[model samples]
Target: MVDIRSPCILVCSIDVKSGFCFGCGRTRAEIASWLSLTSQERDTIMAELPRRLETVERRPRRETRRARIARQRREGQ
Candidate 1:
């Protein structure tokens, strides 16, 4: 089984424009691929996260709910 622990901090917020997790500095694709990555890969990503986060400018959390809605709608039965 893949380890599914989230890299999120309490920030729980995201930048809609960049689709980056504010707390963990990971892109949505990176988060999705986490399970398939080796520990070394994960560690490398983790190590680079701080630098990536430094480049991220804070934006208001506008797309959080929208993203959820879109995702749910896409997955709807």
Candidate 2:
């Protein structure tokens, strides 16, 4: 199966305040139509993710497994 480009880290919960995914920082509409979007479109969205994530008021209940791994890797580096 071809893996389309995605920022998902398997944390599939949405932040109610921002309407963006707690993990990938994408809205439900974006996530639902991701595969159908062009590379440029995805890139545009990806560029905004960090900023969008910062706007999330309510955080996830706990650290996601993928997030922990990424943190460990960054710390190790």
Candidate 3:
């Protein structure tokens, strides 16, 4: 699969207070403009995501697609 420079965790809900997605910590505007942004711009946002997510009060209650795939791979081993 081609690499996608996105922070999405397959959970798309937005946190009103933080103005960031619970999964990717991206704002609605950022996510909306993601496809139009250059790779460098995406990378910069991705780099800042970790710290931005720290402010999110809660996380998704379900396993993400990435986590599920990872789990499946580990189990197959």
Candidate 4:
């Protein structure tokens, strides 16, 4: 069985609002099912991803500068 190549482009981060991965263009369910699919099946999903992404509405991320500073301080860098 040929392993289906992941569409993940090393961008593991998901948009908190959209519940979609910014890197691979996959939903949480799809990502979870990746290993279970054949390469051909994966290809079909990949082909449809662009259109799906276009239709998804993403929530805006709210990050304050103060919060960023606090996080940086905690990281000790």
Candidate 5:
């Protein structure tokens, strides 16, 4: 068996809009069946991850420290 690496970053939240994991850029089905997939399949999915992640909305609904700071700076406060 080949040693296939997992793309999980431990940020398991799924983005509702894209139907992809916010961190790993994989669908629920894909994630669930990952271990059963062949190495070539895994590699193909891995190659598309960057493109998939680009379509995911990563912003938190609530205010974050980094966002707050950026906002304050923009407001010159």
Candidate 6:
């Protein structure tokens, strides 16, 4: 089986207006069936994410735990 990586950044919030996840740029249905999909299907969805993100009112939240900590430290200082 091919490894088609997920775009999830652990921020699972869905944007109400766009109906897509702010992190992975997928709808609930797409995320639900991701593991069952063929590699080609995954690739197709992956290809569209960039364009989808561009149009989305809010961009994906890719903040890692460490980044968040660092950001907080910077802001606190």
**TM-score, one value per model:** 0.59, 0.72, 0.70, 0.56, 0.73, 0.68
What global local distance difference test value does model 5 have? 0.85
lDDT of 6 by residue, 1-77 (tens): 56668988766766767878776788889999999998889899999988776656674346645457778999995
Q: Which is the winner by lDDT between candidate 1 and candidate 3? A: 3
Output candidate 5 Cα RMSD.
7.4
Task: Count backbone overlaps in model 5.
Answer: 0
Write the residue-wise lDDT of candidate 3 on 1-77 in tens digits. 55667787777767777898888999999999998898899999999999989988686556656667789999995
Between prediction 2 and prediction 4, the one with superior TM-score is 2
Q: What TM-score does prediction 5 earn? A: 0.73
lDDT of 6 at 26: 88
Q: What ranking emerges by TM-score with the best candidate at the front?
A: 5, 2, 3, 6, 1, 4
lDDT string for model 5 (1-77, tens) is: 56779998766767888999877899999999999998889999999999999999985345645557778999999
TM-score of candidate 6 against the unseen true structure: 0.68
Error of 1 at 33 (Å): 1.0
Stronger candidate by TM-score (3 vs 6): 3
RMSD in order of candidates: 6.3, 5.3, 4.6, 6.1, 7.4, 4.6
Number of clashing residue pairs in every model? 0, 0, 0, 0, 0, 0
Candidate 4 Cα deviation (angstroms), residue 50 = 1.6
Stretches of candidate 5 above 4 Å error?
Answer: 60-77
TM-score of 1: 0.59
TM-score for candidate 2, residues paired by index: 0.72
Candidate 2 deviant stretches above 4 angstroms:
1-3, 61-77
